[model samples]
Target: MNTYHIDAYKDDIYTCVRSRCGFCFHACPVFLSKGFETYTSRGKCMIMKAFLEGKLPASQGLADRFALCTTCGYCTSVCDVDRPEIFNAFREDLRDAGYTIHRHDEIKETVEKQHSPYGSPDESLASRFAWKIDHGSPLLYYAGCTARYRERAIAEAMMMVLPSFDFLEEAMCCGSVLYRTGYRDDAMRQARALVSRIERYSTVVTTCAGCYKTLTRDYPVMGLQIRPEVLHSTQYLVREYKEGRLALSPVGKGTKVTYHDPCHLGRGTGEYDAPRILLEAMGYEVIEMEHAREMALCCGAGGGLKSINDTMATRIGSMRMDEAKRTGASLLVTACPFCVRNLRDAGGSELDVVDITELIAQSARHEK
Candidate 1:
């Protein structure tokens, strides 16, 4: 019998262990922030190999080391292996062994009970924006947990920019958090429940990057496909703008703003241009960060790292903030609310961070 869940990744892990290229170390958010090899993709592969070889025992220390990753896929960008997949699987193995992170457990429990990791029933956030929900509309807006509870502006901006769209009466966790944190079974349950709730709509749009990826990509991977078409708010906005259906007033007279790609949106789903196109449409000058598009740095809150190790998450976020500041841009914008929250926390008073939806909403010309 396989000793650990990561046994499935043995070939890939062995390849990394033998290669020792260390290419993934270049910009791995956790490795960069923690300044340790154990946090990098190659390093994690080594740990997996040790476990498979029966040289390392499953323990909280080992679990903590694996939990440090942001699951950003930067390593996969440069290397051939799917590091995030391997890391997430390893986390599952650790979880099976009862070596899970405390905070992650709490998040999983809260999500299972409240249907949201934010520790409240879905009704709480939906009621705050009850005026936005319209069952008659075909287009439904899914403001993922972070946007609904943490970054209200993104959801509000999405509704403000869209002339008419339906909002789900209750907030639902997309299960992206649970999936990334090694609760695959629970994540699948949430996915099925959420798909059932929103499958009635003809079209579904979401303002959160994580939610967009989960709805469009991850769900299908789990063999549960969404019935309606799912579009990220940026994708929908850009398409509308292109068709002349949406009018955007110039928000900046060429004011420079840097864009940060949420890992899930950019690499996870290969959505790189929609958000930038929307930014340019709003008349804002787009400044490219050194690590933009496919190679963009993670905001540090992904893969449940923020909940598990906030200090390290913030440190990694600060590194991205520093990169944004170097461009001398006046503002920093990203599609993911989780990115906005973490970047804003790290960038406070140093650089301005806003969701792209907020800027687009500001530039939208609503019919009076």
Candidate 2:
């Protein structure tokens, strides 16, 4: 029996455990999938409480249970009082206990040697948009780890859209993988190096929602200030709209698409509008999955989960694919390459998953 008590780190989450049980369970994908108290937000909260109070034995099971948590914070969104950052703290608790999974080790190895989780940043450094670079260009494009290896089409699409961006001369490692896993020292060190390389740029744009969020939102803590007018691709698309530069044809009668909200891009950073707006501009008759926007479900591959616990990430991603399939969409579109890759991996047997960039670039026109 897992005896549950409140831990000091979990104290931030204490307010949501109300006895009235008002939490809307049907809204949570994790709860729907697991159908248990231990996996539900309330259930996990109770478990953390018991562990903190010394009511439950700290064991291997504890690691699995905590690892099962997606840290999505849907529960906190519904709570009368919110403590959305608790899962991060709880993850730290697990790590402090020497309970990290194997991917953590692999990622650390990549960061230590290659400065990226993908293990190679060289081939990925090439940009189709390099021709746009001029002396003292104000814009730098940041291609995240997955984009460097698996999703070049997205970068290619943005290159087609934004004409004045420069790729980083230095590999462009943002160190988000370190920050998420509580490797504060490495994250800071790696982040400083990235910041120093970009000191010349007045703005930076990224195709990766994770890199955009981490650089713009978290890098300031180290006094590196990754805050150079950062724009996620969609935000740049909306800017294109304002500039009257992006052109689109209608959905052409048969094409239907749905959007998958990347957690960091949507809920974490409040960026649901730009991606959807871009899709709308492209004339996609956008249908939505059950969860969308700030309340949207994660595609289940962010926060280094795909590296650490791939089976769980795949399972969750498969479930997300099923939800997208439910919409009868001909194609599923997303912004994050990680989300695109994970969801495509999920639906490769049965559905089509692609980056919004790839979908758009297929028909995007170049100025004559």
**Candidate 2 has what TM-score?**
0.86
Model 2 agreement with the true structure over 1-368: per-residue lDDT tens digits: 32222254454445445462747465555566667766766776676676676687566677666656555556656663333345545656666677765666678778878877877665633544457755467887777777866777787777666656677654556888777665656788888888777778887788898888778766765467653688887787677665767665554246788888887787667788887777777777789888888677777776666776677778788888888899999888889988888888777568788887776665555443
lDDT of 1 by residue, 61-87 (tens): 998888888888999988867788788
Candidate 1, residue 109: how far the Cα is off, in Å:
0.7
lDDT of candidates 1 onward, in order: 0.86, 0.70
Listed in order, each prediction's TM-score against the native is 0.96, 0.86
Model 2 ranges with Cα > 4 A deviation: 1-11, 18-24, 80-84, 122-129, 220-224, 249-254, 363-368
Model 2 C-alpha lDDT versus the unseen true structure: 0.70
Q: Candidate 2 vs. truth: CA RMSD?
A: 3.8
Which stretch of 10 consecutive residues in model 1 shows the poorest summed lDDT?
120-129
